[model samples]
Target: MRDAEYCFWHSPAHKEEAAEARRLGGQRRRRERVVNAVYELEGMTNVGSVQRLIEIAVQDTLGLENSVARNRVLGTLAQAALRVFEATEFESRLTALESVHERRGKGKR
Candidate 1:
């Protein structure tokens, strides 16, 4: 998943999440992993904070772009995305968030 998509999935609050979750289209565990990541991040920060802590949390907790540590990765991304709102624009962030799910999906170019 792209960095932008990662940001999106983490920040979105409304149907965007539902849509992305639907887009991901997989086992309940995968959906839970993604949503779970976003959920965990919402606590420390809401959105648009973007700071060193956020960066560290994302790369360390979420493993940057690697989902090998799936739960940890999502947790990290969710945290960073919530904070990144301050650093980046709205759509760019959304794209970043969804990118993760997009990559995980079965087919894409």
Candidate 2:
């Protein structure tokens, strides 16, 4: 006899497995959104507005009030910030070195 609660494809024994599959599917979708946001932001000349929007969207979409999801969002933001900071710092140092060399060349002439 077949169980009515589970239909033809799902048996009582597979109930938990079905639930797990649904949960994983949701997680995978959320991750794809995050990855796409990162790629989209990477191509932008300025990411401040877009990044904030994406963060809010991800939080809402992923239920990031939950610590695990929140941590992932925060970690991604931190990495982006670090990369921008390092690049800016390098540019500033390079500019200062060029200025000093230019002043020395002028003095020699």
Q: Which tens-of-lDDT digit does each residue in 1-109 have in candidate 2?
A: 3636666337676778778888999999888789768754443455454556555555664664568767777777667666766777798899999999999999999
Q: Candidate 1, which ten residues in sequence have the lowest lDDT sum? A: 41-50
Each prediction's whole-model lDDT (CA): 0.60, 0.70
Candidate 1, residues 1-109, lDDT tens digits: the string is: 3545445446554458767676667667676678547645433464433354456555665544555676766766776566566455777778987997788784764
The lDDT, on a scale of 0 to 1, for candidate 2 is 0.70
Candidate 2 backbone collisions, by pair:
none
Off by over 4 Å in 1: 1-49, 62-76, 79-83, 86-109
- Each candidate's TM vs. the true structure? 0.21, 0.43
The candidate scoring highest on lDDT is 2
